[model samples]
Target: MELGTSLEKRKVPNMLKRILQYDVQLTKKFVDLALRTTTLKSLRNHAKLFEVSCHGIVWLACWLSFIWLFNNKELYQLQVNMFIALILDIVVIAVIKAFVRRRRPVPMNKLMELGPDKFSFPSGHTSRAVLVAFILICLNPISIIFYPPLLAWVTAVSISRVLQERHYLLDVVCGAGVGLLEGLFMALIWFSQSASASILSSLSDEKLDGGEYHV
Candidate 1:
């Protein structure tokens, strides 16, 4: 339940009752395995849905957008901030990939192996997508409702990475973790800067008052 916890080993109490929506003990017990299998299989099948949640692509698009509007030179401040967030997310992802140094899930393996590459664990797509989704929601609360499709898109992307034989599930999940850390780091920086500015402003106001008294 903690923030950034791996989706694995994420147990659900009363799985049959909750998933199947039948609280009857006998029926629940009877259908537990079926329900569990059905739910997991369905989710894995749809893992492709979360593919778009990749940080690299999302940040690259954001970078392109920034460049596209660069000539205007009057872009909204929010765009600037998003640009910074994108950059930060990317750097964090790269650093994490290097540190983790995991292997791809068996390339071309019938069950796994989609895209084979050097980096694995913590899906970069997942992390970036989640970060973008968070920022978008912060800028406009309404965007939160759209998180489902976005999350699905990101998950699909993660699945695609597997299908393409690039990354394993763990790699994708780890990418998501790095992204979360990046977002949190950005938020803390913004808040700290804002607080410092406020304190400086107060000090300035006090100095002005002392000057006026002397005058």
Candidate 2:
């Protein structure tokens, strides 16, 4: 009847317990808000389609098109830079999700489909949307008229992740941060070097009169 000294149980440290309790409370607040916010119902209804658009097949098609355009067009650096940045974003998100091992917010039954992805600390779809949007804004390849709409779309995509209950608020926040940093990092290196040089050369040539340096 000794019971082997009750297995010498050790309690979790108070600090860790407090942190966990805080996280649970915060998650609950977010979940409650999402449930009550009726404005997001449209996105919630279409959220599965939005989520699947970020799947690997869509990304592959995009990259393949970029590769073709890069080879045939004059925008080699821009296309290559975007392609590489997207690839990097995918790698970074995948690694972070694996390392963190955070579970998705929605139950398996609520999910649209159960596939390769399960863990969801940082929302990969949100990250990719932010990264792509950031790249286009920085590069300025498209007309200014299109930027606002593109930004709105990106915002909607990020919100849809939460509305669909696939991710918590913090997951999208961290994912956005990671994506923005990646975009800035790529822009600083790629745009500052080759892109800048090409742009400057074009500007200088436009000012040239007879091949001598213009004052």
lDDT of residue 180 for candidate 1: 68
The CA-based lDDT of model 2 is what?
Answer: 0.71
The number of clashing residue pairs in each candidate reads 40, 0
Model 1, span 1-215: residue lDDT tens: 56447434444457633532332233233233323576544544555544433536655786666544343322333444566677787677677767655555443336653453467655667677767666666542344668787666655665455444455444555666776677676666543334533443354443323333333
Candidate 2 residues 10-85, lDDT tens each?
3446896586567656766765666667866666778878877665558768776655433332454565677677
Model 1 bad stretches (over 4 Å): 1-58, 70-75, 109-117, 139-145, 163-165, 191-215
In model 2, the runs with Cα more than 4 Å from the true position are 1-24, 69-72, 108-114, 191-215
Instruction: Rate residue 4 of model 2 by lDDT.
Output: 48
Number of the top candidate by lDDT? 2
Write down the RMSD of all candidates, one decimal each. Answer: 13.7, 9.4
Q: Which residue pairs in model 2 clash with each other?
A: none
